[model samples]
Target: MTIKQHQSPHTIGRNFRLIAGILALAACAKPANATDVFRFEGFGAISRGMGGVATAYDTGLSGMMTNPATLSLMETGSEIQLGFDFVSTDIEVKNKATGEHVSSDSHGNNRHPYFAPQIAYGRQIGSLTLGAGVFAQGGLGTEYGRDSFLSRASGNLDTELGNSSRLLVLNIPLAASYKVSESLTLGAGVDATWQGLNLDLLLGADQVGSLMGAGRVSGSLVPVLGGLPDLRGAHFSLTRNSPIKSGVSAWGHTARVGMTYAFSEDTRVGVAYTAKSRVADMEGRATLTAIDGVAGQIALPGDITIRDFQMPAVLNLGLSQRVSDKLDVAVDVSRVYWSDVMKDIKVGFVSDSGGDINILLPQDYRDQTVLAVGAAYRASDKWTLRGGFRIAQQALRGSTLFAVVPAVPKKHVSLGAGYAFSERASLDFAWSHAFEEQMDNEGTPNTSAPIRVNHSQDNVTLVYSYRF
Candidate 1:
């Protein structure tokens, strides 16, 4: 393996290490909502069946995130549910112009796959019910080709540009579903969810020259200017730590109220609402280490930066109808305030050199609205069928913050089924496909910077839900 040589270190720095560029890209990875939690439909069954259970979900512990109101409605008794999730995904990136495939695939790359486990348990006593569960909200892991553009052209010498992140949120809830009268049932739950995120950004030799788009330019070669003598063997490296910080989220506390009204002998209508929490305080560290032997070693002090983050509230409405002795159908409609995440991220820092730090997050995307429609049917005495669809706008299609590492969007079709084997237990399975979409940031019309990018994601998930 060989690293190319250049006449000037500035051009070399621009064309080679792109070490600064790496820092810029790394900056974007830690958003106010840095990691994803509470996925669209976490388990395979919910996904394959379209996650339409907002109104008629099983009374298991997993129902807290979807609709706490359902707590008063169903009976799971003393049941314990446990399962694991397996995921596999593929990504294709290209250049918008000339239909060129700029992103490398055969550079010895592997698809994204992971194992996640979760459990839910619930019990009722008198008019009060209690539930608790440990489950991952949602997250993404993407580490592609070691020989890709970002890797080959950069100064990592390690020869790769890799990044991955995982996040999980735990929900502990207590509630009561009271029978106010013969025709009505009223219920409520206090929700407290804990959040956490883990992130990593890596670079190798292959990613060096690619950072500056590797063209050509020349400059004076000397060590006295406080820069590398040339762009070749001088050796340069930078490692940064995202300072350590812990948060007991302010917005994790809220109240939920739900009411179920009996319309007739076989029909019921339910409505539920919950107050939103004030989410803020994203404080973290920024420790940097720099080595430019050609220009001499220079290490920057660690900096502390914080951002104020917020999340929108949610509302759900659902209905359940019994059609025959062996059949029933259910559907639900829900809304989320994605617009709350529409602002650019901002950061304030305290420089060790006695200077105030201030920087604006470059996120300039529109608020989003999502629509979920799903259903489940007991087709026979021993079998149940489910299907559903969901649609939401993409925030990364053409944003100012496009990087070699991309963010995933949610939009797909799902199908699933379940079988009752005996009086004590049952089995279920589900499958889905997210429709592909194209992206290009360079030529989106009227932009000074001309960097082009295009990509899409494909995914598969499997899980198991049990009753005892």
Candidate 2:
């Protein structure tokens, strides 16, 4: 349905005054992960509660990130949203040839569940709406022990089997919106994002065994290894948990633009586009070790630098309609350009004692599209309920899907509710779950052995808002 905002110009001063009171609170909040890889399904509880069908809806401060034009539909005042996301993820890797699996829990102790915070502010001033928000781009990671099946299959020593990787991106968005006519609004925004990444990974036993077995010399050292009897083995091991670690951080920028149009009292449409972000290279210190049988030991100690890492662009279209007085429905379709940015993961290693080595991890990811539908019901003057579902195509499949980054799940279901304590204050809560998904790889450019990955996730969100 079309949610309208008044633009009489008389309330501009009041809106600014109200915004001043909540600016501090809004500045202290941040966003957490949803159900996407390096990307969240939505920006806030209200958006996620409705399965991210928010492009055409007025969802207060949170929705501004999805479509800044939605800001023009806010009540003639100021508001702030503060919330947290509790996320739990399960990741498992299997050796398809041996029929053994290793769970993330088999590694070192981890928090198991983690928390992500969200905050935002919106204020109406004359014919314009102003807003600011903080949230995280989604990411996943897990740690495994050296003694786990992951290590045994690789035939690596106890110290060489451990693995882990974690990525975090904090986005600070500043946006503005203006009403172009009685039924149309346009908006734009800029996001200054800070990204950090910590990765402890390996080539694993399967890939190493395949490469050495081929003896085709993928790199200069591969052919040399074939001549060494000690290096020719059926199994191999590699790890990243040496004295030096592979961790890096950088700053990036992205832009967003959107528009909303009201076709009638009962129908509205919205469209938005986010440009790809430019990110800097990640450099860190780490040791690369490869062991075959008992006498095969290859140690490459160096500073690892991953270059040309970038975030993909996105396009979203949505429609919202009122089916009846108390019920409203919304649908959204979004496309993510993963293939444009993730053709391969290239790492440059400068040896501490000698030369340089370059490793290319081919991803060949495909663009992904997501479809979402949601329904919201105003059950009573004080209560509102929401339910939604979303399904998306996975970015990686076939042999390119690796253990380190398993973006497998494709379906998500969500439920949410809102309770109003007063005309200006309320609480909102949402829960979502992603069904299990798995991928198997027989062999690819990066691996010659059979490997499998499985994944699932759950998220919970709570937000408190006040309007003045």
Candidate 3:
């Protein structure tokens, strides 16, 4: 046999891998949010539908960062996929005073129906596979009406009163996997991460004083809190609008490495480590609006900046097993180093009269562990069904949870399905819902009285793929 004839198949695979690499890199860009404070369990429709079980299982390019070694399982040809997710989130805050109990009315808030997009491609050659993708990894945000009960309690009568936040990370991962043996593969990737943030806040002076502590505030704030005869029992309302007034964005880079081992034809396990993306400070526009029943109104022009903002590293492990020809199951566990990057949220503002003001909101967040399990069933050559469950430990508690980000839910249920339209094309769909969870802090030093926040979410994802 001639060498050219023997190498024909390998040559074709190499060409396919090169074409896939070019397409994947050319399509890399931004998209938009998922899990934790703004972290997602999975990146594509198949994985999300399977309760984020991509770490060990082969789910096309979506598993690159989760476990790049999964790429070695791909077919010799090239494949491309695009996915979109629609997310809805809800947040509620309740305040308790001596005689008054008020809950935030955020029904039909209309801030949700968020859209996130993702794309990826992969190809296999002789013993190597290469790929790249753009994924919207994580984000958090909430919206409330101006006439909500919380707004009224905060003393907003002339204008709207609400607090909202948007944190998004776009990751571009360039990855390669090498098949060391028939059952073992190793892979690694470099990630270029882009992060964006927008914060709109309205806090009562009492709440601010509690969070900032008395020592951090100037003596002038004491008189406004009720020392003056005309200002007794009077409160100041602080307003910060950053999304529209002033926007904040930053870019950083990180990397991940992983390995996958196949114990048998029906079982496999994978592990991976992702480094933190160190980003710059986020600066935006802010205004402090204080409404005093006795002194009328006070507005201060300032800028809001949060320093040393970063995303923490993660360690992930996964296992996948095929119980039968028709049934497959997978599980994943992850440890998130939140305390490394979220120890404190420092808010600094510079005003025309007050000069420079700095407030340190202590997060002291604890590390979190996430668990996920999923099952997929192949009923027929053209039809597949999937179901999954996921849960994560809370990173913060008590007053700190309510004072900072309070929308991290603890549990989720997911369902998904796939249909093959042709020999080379398929459609996938997934739906996941987070159960409502709440945390309450009663008379904590970080909060004057009692404060509680409730949160939940619903997500739908769809993707289309073609292989050649």
Candidate 4:
């Protein structure tokens, strides 16, 4: 953590404290209730309003997350931007055979209307621009009450069988861009990321049997108690209320490279590649509760480890054009290599009472292709209007295990506005709505009945910026 030599000691100390504060805030933040398979469609208000298009166009300091090369396109000065997103998600899971539905909104503990904060600063020096920021990458979560069918199916009809799952990722990026020529810019960045997961889940005997039949369960418990003759009515659960208090979390790192080229003064093209993240195993403590018809119920405190969980690599290509002096249009295409990273999630549990169990949750997610298109109109000297559309292919491959962590929305529409109130201050606001999507798991191995999940989401972002 070194600051520029020209800065005074007091300034350096203040900056260090600021970074620490940012990390603390990010640690307590919740998931965004993702739109693109656990990933947000956009990063900042400017990008959200313009359909997540920032590769080829200047999008203030927030461009560090999308296309760092665009940093060089900013006005020659120092700029700071601060913003937050209010996310509202609607999710429902239904057991088609039982005709019972559980809505996330039904639970009093359901943490809806999640908030994600964003802050960034960039400065221009000679032909180079340097910037840094903290923001959320993306995440997914769901909550079901104890009275839901899932809890009843677990044979915990009277007990408080808390059922929920949450996954969150936050990123702090340090980026820089160099203007190679009047028409070309090159940039790169390094990201320090923190990822956390909390799960309070219960699995029924049939589901466990299916997993065992598929060879997805292993460890000491399997060889010992797994062979018991009366294991037919068994139930298993791992419960943790909060990630910060007692859940699995890890820190990881990644990098990005991007370049922007101007075909003409009115048209530009940008390309960016983000490498996959390398995260440590998420390890934490939870209560592993087991219940069986013959052996009754037992609760064992244990440690759990989630192995080799990582984010997918992505490639983005974008084109921006000035349709008129007052109108600008942009389109972007992105490919996410999800299959490589989301094949399966392996969890290993070790209890103090000498119980070792390994479980595999199959994701089998496919690669995703996303397309975004947006336009901005300068209505007056102080006002600008923006609108955009985005679409993506389904990533999950019909896995019944995804019922709790559904990321099913595939289409989104957004609208935004920007207002300049003074020579050095401006405000931007954007809203995005994801259409409801439903998916069914008919042929999945772990389910006795078909499971259907419906998901929809809304995001609103407001940002204020100042230039000096």
Candidate 5:
């Protein structure tokens, strides 16, 4: 899908009851941000092969996050895995600026590399199989350099704004599967997840200079139209120490449970659910400073504590069939309860000079269902191939809260491959590209101006696995 917009991320701070972190992006009744992207989806090859299905029969390492029921699927000997991913994102935005009424087009780059490790061990102790592992799941991130259109607008509006965000989770998982009778296996596990959220917003005269992203930058007269002040002549310090950033630390827990049953030798069914979590210990703080013109700028101190804001609960039910000895297929139906995510947030101002607090919120969304299907084929003792598809529903509730975080059309396709280098070692590679639907962004500071954006995703992953 095409990517666009961050105005939505700011809303999480406006309300506490919606999303978990005032520091993280706000939760919407719809998709949070059309432009927001996740890199964790393809950190490893196995996740790509089965459309991220492993909650029941997971193996290798990263399986820890895909499902807890997979505990019993592990080999008695331990397995360790190493993985890495490279992403190249390109985003185009059409902007309405301060001085010029004419619209301008700007482009940006998303460059980042990620590393992940996964390990799992299982042993038969009488009637039960047990396993444990730690792995990374999906989250959101954005690092936008200040650009010309935004800079000119910031200088004229008397605002300094730059943002950086990161979110990661440490998953402590414990699970077991017990075989009852001859045809049923029941399993469950709790993923005691501790989430870490961080955000940084910077402002100053150089905010424009940074957005333009060139040499030592400078700001001139504040541009104006009808009724407004021209507070100008601010030269910003480009030092890292001058600008300030605000952040939060939050903690919470969620659970997952599942059961797998075989109707025949070639057919099996699986069901699982992940619980929702709330962060009560979320702490926040913002720093204040000036780069060039301190006399005219706003001096501010940030705030932190809020209510039980956080992510939602998710559930999945699946069916897998072995059509032949070398061919296998599976399908999963999943749900996400995004309606529990509505909140209003606030940001404190130094002088209250044209400022009260930054207040905004996400709209009421509904539960959404996804239909995902995948297949795996064994070409030989050393080679395997995989493919999958998923249809994600747009559960947006059209309202004022939906303005900033516009949802996009949902559907995805993936392909992957695996090769055994030895009896204990293998290499895997996978790639997926999502098609985006066209959408319009309306009602900015300017009511008539429109930002048209489309969404698309290109994901590639590589993994190394050694099965002992």
Candidate 6:
């Protein structure tokens, strides 16, 4: 005889709820208006206020997420930090021919005041330090309604062509640092990363025809449907408009290594390198619909996959100097290798009706160089003030497909302050403002209408720390 056991209905329901809650939390982790293209300019309040200059300075446990070597500079005890970033974006798109424009801030339904949380813990043991933390790397997104000029330009003047895109990246890192000598320290970390993407796009008939003529669109469905002469007025769309949905997600891994050396009691230098992420293909399900003057409308539900999308590697170098007993200054320079990963975006759609299609979107992004400088003044034993400025090179070589995801800001000004409430607790706050930038794209073979985008943003960070 054999005996078998099955889970009760109550247990199964409880498990289902738990899984759903986790997925919901992940889906709602949205980020916007990152300063370094789609990547944030800094990690924590102190770094943000100091022009992202954590490479050589001690900014609490948050340094573990950037230059791990700085962790060795913390006091020999246990520390916990909690923080969050609040971001606000202002973006507008215009059709030069139609003289019509749409603002990302005008849509009431558009989610604003985005928030991302950070938490970290570190412990110092003799000459070594260990730490762990969760942080949001950065992301870009925008929303426009059906009545917007973008919808009218797509030839769907009356339909709900909500053009949008949202991308979010999160990291959980385990790091360790060791003090090699009185003036030298080295560190490394391994990061587990998660990325999510959501998109809603509509392409006009002219663009669709150009993609076909250029051989950029292909698949099993091409032979069966491509030959139709009535396709002249056809349009294509991949749409999912809900803000609470992740649409597609993937997991990846990366690593970072860094070192710091003190030249004297008043001067120090640091260097760090972060490897590119190796993420899996983003996979999900969505509706792929086509509208034609002759065929009327055809909708195919399918699974979608975004292939070969990865983050770029970065190198950072920095120096810090103690000019006086109450004044300190720091500077950092970084190189971002964006050209390696931003060549082309390939989208694969496998329709439930039995055919698969592939679409190619070219980005042609260039590498970027960033420089930052900051100063901090100690007004008293309980008060400190900080100010900084940062400048970055333009990352995109062209603006063809950037109208929807405009990461164009190139300069920022920041201010911050820190207060010590007690020996064991403290508070830090920072604010950064990105200057407005505008870019114009010439008419391409796919469409004759020139497009212009204007973008700017503001970011605020607050952190609370407790040491034991």
- Scored by TM-score, the top model is 4
* Model 5 segments more than 4 A misplaced: 1-44, 55-61, 84-87, 96-126, 151-160, 200-246, 288-295, 305-307, 342-360, 395-409, 444-449
The residue-level lDDT of candidate 1 at 56 comes to 46
lDDT of 5 at 402: 20
> Model 5's lDDT to the true fold?
0.48
The model with the greater TM-score, 3 or 4, is: 4
Model 6 accuracy (lDDT, Cα): 0.77
Tens-digit lDDT track of model 4 for 1-468: 011224445744564465445435433333348788877888888899988888898778888998899999988899988777766778888888778898875253334334667889999999999999998888877777667766654443334566777777888999999999999999999999888887766666667778888989988877655554444333334434433332788899999999999989999999999899999999988766665556655677878899999989999999999999899999999999999998888888998889799988778889999999999998887788999999999888765546677788999999999877555666788999999999888634445457888888888877777676
* Candidate 1 structure, TM-score to reference: 0.66
For 1-468, candidate 2 gives per-residue lDDT tens digits of 222343234454454455345433432322122466667777677777888788998767877678889899888899887776666667778878778777765243232234456788889998799999887666655665556554442443443445555566667889999999878999999999776665555564556555435442244444443455544222212223322222666677888999999999889999999889877787766665655565555666777677778788999999999999999999999999999989877766666666655666778888999998988999987788998999998888667776656767789999999877556666787888888888888864454457788888777777777677
TM-score of 3: 0.81
TM-score list, all predictions: 0.66, 0.84, 0.81, 0.89, 0.69, 0.89
For 1-468, candidate 3 gives per-residue lDDT tens digits of: 001112245654564465345334422221122566668767677788888888889877788968888999887789887776666655566765533343322222222334556788888888999989888878765544455434442333433545445566778999999999989999999988887665545555465556546454443444444443332121222322432222466678889999999999999999999998777777766665555555655666666577778888999999999999999999999998989988877666666566565666667888999999999998887888999999999887675664335656878889999877555666787888888888887753345447677777777777777677
Task: Please write out the lDDT profile of model 1 over residues 280-382, one tens digit for every residue.
Answer: 4544444322223244333334344335544445576767676765445556565655445535434344435444434343445544445556666767655
Residue-level lDDT of model 5, residues 1-468, one tens digit each, is 011323233432332222123112211111112211222342257656666555444434555444555445555555555554333332223432222221111111111222233444445565677666655544433343343333333334434343334444455567667767455767766766555444433433333333224322212212211012432222221112211122554566667777777788788777777777655555555443333332444344444333355556778777778899888888777777766654322222222232222222324566677776778888887788888876777665333212123344466677899877555556777776566654544532211233443445555566665554
**Best to worst by lDDT, what's the order?**
4, 6, 2, 3, 5, 1
Q: Taking the candidates one at a time, how many backbone clashes does each contain? A: 24, 6, 1, 0, 25, 0
Best by lDDT: 4
Q: How accurate is candidate 2 locally (lDDT)?
A: 0.70
Which lDDT values do the candidates have, in the order given?
Answer: 0.44, 0.70, 0.69, 0.78, 0.48, 0.77
Candidate 5 to truth, TM: 0.69
Task: Rank the candidate models, highest TM-score first.
Answer: 4, 6, 2, 3, 5, 1
Report RMSD (Å) for each prediction in the order shown.
Answer: 15.7, 6.3, 7.2, 5.7, 13.3, 9.4
| Deviation in Å, model 4, residue 229 alpha carbon | 6.5
- What local lDDT does model 5 show for residue 383? 84
Model 2 misplaced regions, further than 4 Å: 1-34, 109-113, 153-160, 204-229, 232-246, 292-301, 444-448
Q: Give the TM-score of candidate 4.
A: 0.89
Tens-digit per-residue lDDT, 1-468, candidate 6 = 011334456744564465345334433333366889888888888889988778898878888777899999898899988777767788888888878888775242234334667889999999999999998888877777557656542344334556666777888889999999989999999999998777766666566666778777899976655655444332333433444447788999989999999999889999989899999998898777665555645677889999988888999998999999999999999999989988777789888889988877767888999998988888877788999999999987544555667899989999999876545556788999999998887655323357788888888887877676
- Count backbone clashes in candidate 1: 24
